[model samples]
Target: MSEVDNYEIVRQKLTLGPLTTPKHRKIRRLLKIFWNEKEINLLSHFGPADEYNSLKQLQERSGLPKDEIKQILRNPLRKGTISKRGTKYCLEPIIPGIFEKYFQRSRDTEENLKKAAILYWDLFKEVLPQQDTKVDNDWSLFRPLLPLEANEKIIEINQEFDVQSQTLPYESVKNLIDKFEQFAVITCQCRLVAELSGEPCKVAPSEMGCFIAGPGSQTMIDGGIRGARLLNKDEAIEFLKETEKRGLVHNAVFDKGDQSSIFFCNCCGCHCGVLFPPKLFHERGAYQSNYSPKWDNDLCTKCETCMKKCPQKAIYHKFPVKSDSSDEQMVLREEMCIGCGVCAINCSDKAIKMVKVRDNVPPDRQKIGNKTFIEMLQ
Candidate 1:
């Protein structure tokens, strides 16, 4: 087939579900960079979609011998472009799927990481058009994760501990871990993206902040996907606490808001895909973190740290040169805060606190919410 024909097949495959058609030409250019003619030929063997089927099936369709197909498939598997399920092989999606391979390669491949970063930004630009448009359900892909907020510094604020209702399984990272069985730790893709773009995570080490749990981990782990390792319940909780201390927002991807998801990411405002992109457009993306920052003027030292730290730029610093220096203030737009709680993690003055909005708290969740991992994105 000619180059155009080849590009079309790949394009059609990429547009499937979670992966989407790029609204910009740069996305096409980026794809051409990674998937050349030979690679595209091999990829076509899987057809489209992430499904589990035997190698013989692929061989039947590709008309290539098992050995030849295996040779070509090895590269994509190691690169994480595709995954295996026992004797079966399948294609991975784009957004929450194929982009992960870039992080796996980033560990030892700087050139790959840099290229991936460029592509991510380009694709992010492609999605910019959707910023102002509201989702049909007015839902986002992630709920703002509320990790344990009772740090020792809160005592200095001298406020009563009125955050008792905050302790829900979906809101707390530790409790979320308790609900899952299998556990795995992986590199934070967003953090890796930032590092590739020359701004690494200042708090949590980029390599240790992503975690996957539940039955899904069993399948991916057994499939030998890179960038994930099994963890015990206790180990997973400790890692979450460590990430929390680093000031990363906890984004648990549980089904609905109660079922443990395949992964929980310790994300930052600047690097994470959903957070940073929405912040750029002055709003949250497909997912809302379900928490917002509440600035306490009585306890605020007016340091304006929260303003600089917010990924969404939700905090607006209001200060006048003519007024007393202590009059400096930070203002928060309630609708803009996704509730990731980065501002409240370690406030030196304990001024910013994350509170559950009256109408936006997690639902009672009578049944499983997300039927599939990519349902929210698609």
Candidate 2:
């Protein structure tokens, strides 16, 4: 296609969710070129499609070379500035409010949001590289019930325990998601496969994802995931049920407030960023668990199988028995364990088991009453 035609094609594609008419694509390409300039912003305040100058008019007005004009129009940054209706170009600003409305319209109807979330999760897993291959023989860490409560209450509880703070409020999470238009669920698989012979997963993205709730400055940070929404109590329950049915495991639910407020179902690991910060500050080596694993030496056969499958590198073969003994034992370092039950499930001899050390307090109901957490954003 001609350069003009190509720009039109890109514009159409972006407008129509990557499924664009050729003409639309061309328009998108052209708009990207001039999007961020002071002149474009000035033009935006002037008027709509008919009132605003055409591409040729803009090129002449800006006094830029033909190639430079073409470059700006074709750039991805300017895609939000021009709208195509029939055969006309219109001035449109890609302000936060406009983007929010667009996303809300797309994700709020017909369960499209859910489908997008699932797709994002799938893509995340595929892109993440595997680091450790060791299996966790401990099962106790997985047994604890997931926590659900208002974001504020979680912060309070963590403080009470003297745990270093890293939790984000539900409103904050939503705002981040909304501003970025995408967010990722990052998991540390390093400890999960540490005991295995091969490399463990250094970073595994989460299968559960969320979208942002509003437009704001806090949501623009690079590490932040965008497009997050809050899930109220009922919605949180429903989300868990749906995720479970899909075979994705998660722990903890962050309730921001109302039925539609944002929530995050967290998964724990020694290497995960959320737990890492607290672990480092506390000098606890990044372990975040109330339970630890115990081994039955009598049942362990010194075959050293468990040692090969630990994700946290917590297990090792040591002290070979005298000739008379039937069992050779593997040692577990409690401090190094993250408590994911990978090793226990992988053990062939059924010798490994997890035991809970202490229980976490249940979430407080009074703090997270029935109001939309989005109200807090305002």
The TM-score leader among the candidates is 1
Off by over 4 Å in 2: 1-271, 275-290, 303-305, 325-327, 362-378
Per-residue alpha-carbon lDDT of model 2 for 1-378, expressed as tens digits?
643333332233232211112232222332433344543433433333224245566556556665665455443222233443333344332211123222222312334334332332222232211212121322111211222221222222322334433232322232333334333332222222121213233333333433222233234233232333444434545554443333222332223232123223333333332233233333222223443446667766667666665534668887746786545567777766655444554455667664444433323221112212232111
Worst 10 residues of 1 by lDDT: 151-160
Task: Go through the candidates in order and give the clash count of each.
Answer: 8, 74
Q: Indicate the residue-level lDDT of 191 in model 2.
A: 25
Q: Write the per-residue lDDT of candidate 1 for residues 1-378, one digit (tens) a residue.
A: 644566556666654433355445666665665666776776776656545547788788878888887887777666666666567776655566667664655333567658777677655545744535332243334665566544332212222333554445565555656577668876677776767767676756666756767876665466554466777877776776677666676676533443333556777766677566666666665355444567788788777677676666777878856656666678887667666666787678878766555434444431212224433211
Q: Please list the C-alpha lDDT of all candidates, in the order they appear.
A: 0.61, 0.35
Off-target runs (Cα >4 Å) in candidate 1 are 1-4, 16-19, 23-25, 50-57, 105-110, 125-139, 150-166, 177-185, 197-205, 212-242, 254-262, 320-328, 359-371, 374-378
